[model samples]
Target: MSIKSATPYFLLNGRTEQAIALYQRALGAKTESLQRFGDVDGSCPTAMRNRVMHAMLRVGNAVLMMSDGPEDVKLPEGGNVSVALDFETPAALRQSVEALAATGKVLERVFEAPWGALFGVVQDEFGIQWMVTSPLK
Candidate 1:
């Protein structure tokens, strides 16, 4: 069997909506589809029924998937994973960094890297880390 595509899936605890909103504002992401737990068969708990079961967000050319996972599950503290975004221009990269910094923590201000590209890192309010970079000219 051959693998087709790999997508980043986020289990946002109970903050799926908030994460989606942040992505939309920072990355110009568009919601392709969203499904509430209540939309599924009656197996979901009452409290979770109104929560997002699944969502598809289109950010640039990538599709980011997300959901409000099971109520009993808790995300680990300081996870090692991060979402990397590469931009075609340095101006675009800086704009995205500024947008995310409005509501997120900028770990690194945009600067030219030793590899000859502009790079920065930000951790959003939802605790998702993003590594933003611009292609070398």
Candidate 2:
């Protein structure tokens, strides 16, 4: 298969581990690999070394990556963009939303929209926005 330039890469703060876990619970994420900052065998500072330097979780067809922020760097406020999920079934859609709501804020409930698809929006506990939907045939 050929690659495309359309995929997104999110830059999260110091909660890489927690974010990964949340996605796992809500999206059936399977962590492909996680390299801690301490795992960086280079000459990086001790404080910076043990932090998450790089980690990847494969959530279905998407790959989400994360890492720690600089020592004192704070996460930014709400911005553009949200994760989009296409569910395979209505049951999956409902279950996923309920699970996500456990640790996140539900902006909207999953329901049939005027656009002819069931959709909803949420913000995970880690402050990441998500939009789940399933198209009707």
Candidate 3:
């Protein structure tokens, strides 16, 4: 069988829900499904009961998977991976950027790049990084 599609899986420590909410507001994304840790096991730690075990978000035509990682593991820095969002218009791009930046930090504000496009980097409040870009015309 051939691979149908690949989605990025974002593993946050304890803020997957908030991140999902932000994504919904920022990109008008839809939540296809979300399961809390407790849903899978009643014996799960109380702290993890409310945490997302798995969640699927539909952004534009892409699906993103997110979860609150296991409680006892230490996560390393998020390196070499980022979600890239492409917008069709400047207004749409700006609106999304503003929404995403409310509780997020801008790594690089959108600007005209030498490559003839507007590019920027931002890390959401939940710690997932994003590369926002749009064509300049």
Best by TM-score: 1
Query: Candidate 2: which pairs clash?
Result: 37-49, 37-51, 38-49, 38-50
What's the lDDT for residue 23 in model 1? 85
User: What tens-digit string does per-residue lDDT give for candidate 3 at 10-30?
Assistant: 888777877888998998899
Off by over 4 Å in 1: none
State the C-alpha lDDT per candidate. Answer: 0.86, 0.77, 0.85
Ranking by lDDT: 1, 3, 2
**Count: clashes, candidate 2:** 4
Superposed Cα deviation of residue 105, candidate 3 (Å): 1.6
List ranges where model 3 is wrong by over 4 Å: 1-3
RMSD of model 3, in Å?
2.1
lDDT digits (tens) for residues 77-111 of candidate 2: 33587878888877788778888789778999777
Comparing 2 and 3 by lDDT, which wins? 3
Q: What is the lDDT of residue 58 in candidate 2?
A: 83
TM-score of 2: 0.85
